[model samples]
Target: MLILKIFVFVTSAIYACIAKNIILIVADDLDVVLDGMTPLSSTRKYIGEQGVTFKNAFAAVPICCPNRGSILTGRYQHNHKIFNNSLEGGCYSQTWRAGYEKNTFATILKNRMNYNTFYAGKYLNQISITISWHQY
Candidate 1:
């Protein structure tokens, strides 16, 4: 039993040490094809060069709030139910709070993967006091 416990502890510690860090940067109206990244040379040098870059990624929703919802929940606009940047469109609406907010990528990383997560910048157009750091 002591040997098993020691093995478990050692394995857990090793796994924790090897856990990769995650960084998600969402830039609005920035297009790679249009030389949008040229101004962020320092960011490109420090983060882009050292990290994996998705050169061919495209947003399925093409609009701010709906696209953000899709990014967070890893769902299509139809599945996430966010049609636009309005409360009526389900951007930070009660339905989104109740159904989709709890299961976002940030929440999953923080809860299931045991990662310390941080979020900054505008989330959604209709987002107000209902936002929490833990839920971002």
Candidate 2:
């Protein structure tokens, strides 16, 4: 009876329609000002009233590559080991090793949770966000 119930639950979950798919959107160079110096007053109101605000959000590091990598990987920069910008002009990537797999959220989420992931930003760290995914 227990085994049957477990099987039923698992099967139901597998076939259950996704009510609302979760979308984690992180925008780099967004100049997110949750405090004061924000020019996006209208956006602030929208995000303030309708959004799930996180006041104590702190990046692992100030640097983009390492921090974005860390956010994706769920691992610290030390763990993934991307320390500095490989690029020079701060426009595009200049890394010697650029085959994805730096330290990012999409890679970890896709690899672990098997969820459909999408990234749109400056992707010149060590990974690209062009990944294919489906529930079928």
| Model 2 steric clash pairs | 69-103, 72-104, 72-105, 73-104, 100-127
Ten-residue region with minimum lDDT total, candidate 1: 127-136
Candidate No. with top TM-score: 1
Error of 2 at 85 (Å): 2.3
Q: 1-62 in candidate 2: lDDT tens per residue?
A: 99999998887587555535667656555455554426657766887668866657778978
Query: What's the number of clashes in each of the models?
Result: 0, 5
Residue 97 in model 2: shift from native, Å?
6.6
C-alpha lDDT of residue 10 in model 2: 85
Candidate that scores best on lDDT: 1
| 2-48: candidate 1 lDDT, tens digit per residue | 99999988987898999998767887876777887889998788878
Measured by TM-score, how close is model 2 to the native structure? 0.56
Reference-based TM-score of each model:
0.75, 0.56
Q: Give stretches of model 1 more than 4 Å off.
A: 1-9, 32-56, 128-136
Which portions of model 2 miss their true places by more than 4 Å? 1-20, 28-37, 87-105, 108-114, 125-129, 132-136
Per-prediction CA RMSD (Å): 3.5, 5.9
